[model samples]
Target: MKSVTRSLRVLEAVAQHQPVTVGELTKLFGLPKSTVQRTLVTLAEAGWLRANRKDTTRWEIGARVLAVRPAALQGSSLFAAAREPMIRLRDQVNETIHLSVPDALHSMVVVDRVDCAHAVRTFHAIGDTSPLHATATGHAVLAHLAKSELDEFTAGTLKEYGEETITDPGELRAELRRVKDRGYAVNHNQYLQGVCAIAAPVLDGDGVPLAAVAASLPESRFASGLLPELGRMVTDTAAEITARHPR
Candidate 1:
């Protein structure tokens, strides 16, 4: 019984401080390293946690958690506010529209999606996660982060997803600055080859980013001439979502 209780506590801790190292968990719980590791392994085996993709030693919440609490993704006020706007954006661009929220400072998790009519449209499951430096949604959120938070995020390793991924710290910083100035971010086969996206941050009343709204489509459909128009449409939809969402 005590072991089960400990495992539950460890699971809660992992959810709160995701992408956390086992050593950090041990220190937080004041437990033996072996004991904490065992607890983590148990939770992971039970589908409550999974190791970070970039750093295997660190753990984050797993898909099963989302599967169990489906309402947390679709029943929230953010989803309610974003639904109509997302549908409108998809209709305007004829591309898949995604609403994603940051999972701590590591990754962005897709919370909702409005699919386009085209058979060749992009798709991301509700719980799909993507690196912050490798997707337009992630970059939009990163561009709105507070300076200290941005500094801390930039200090971490930027894992490369593909050749287009910005692995250099300086380059990423520059790109984020550009995103901040332009009110949106764009990705060209950065995270997934043959995929393209444009996104804008949904900011709260205080200007803190709450989520990002992105238009995702195939590379074949992402023409240079259409980028400006797509960017404007996406940013406008994101702004509408921000207005509709309660701060």
Candidate 2:
């Protein structure tokens, strides 16, 4: 059990200051070089740490660390909050419901989702990253960000996922402006062809965007004339979720 305790301590140390070398870990923990080396090797083999690609001499926490963290677990609660609402919305609109939150960087991570009962329902895996510009959820959240933050995100070149994906930053900015005014976002075959999504921001305790709630369906299922009603369903569902959040 002593080795296990030492291993956990080493993991905690690495997690706190990643990309650490053997010497740094030894110095930080006041352990011998051999002890730190053995512990690090064991932790790395267990999928807790990953050797840096650029500098193989150093190690950082692995993606598996994301699964064990408290924040990731807490994020799953967003699904719990949306379960009944999602079911209700899915039944009402006969569409799939997706719940997503911002990940470490530019991507929006899908935390939870429910698929429609139909065979042709839209399907997405949990923990998958969606493009911020091409997804309905992404637009809803980005539309609410501060100008400085939004500028920083859009400064880099964006990849074109589909023909309908917005490559022009200026046009995207205008679309975000429209989303801000309407309090909802729409993706018409922007990310995936044949699918359309409507999204709205789920606010935090202080009314900041915490996540986004979206309803996605095959274009064939919803007619163009029903766009306004579809937008309203997403916006109203997100509002219901925000009201449940404790301020």
- List per-prediction Cα lDDT, in the order shown: 0.91, 0.84
CA shift at 91, candidate 2, in angstroms? 1.4
In candidate 2, position 61 carries an lDDT of 86
The per-residue C-alpha lDDT of model 2 at residue 49 equals 90
| Worst 10-residue lDDT window, candidate 1 | 66-75
Pairs of residues at least 3 apart in sequence or in different chains that clash in candidate 1: none
Off by over 4 Å in 2: 1-77
Superposed Cα RMSD, model 1: 6.2
lDDT score for candidate 2 against the true structure: 0.84
lDDT accuracy of residue 123 in candidate 2:
83
At residue 151, give the lDDT of candidate 1.
91
Candidate 1 similarity to native, TM-score: 0.77
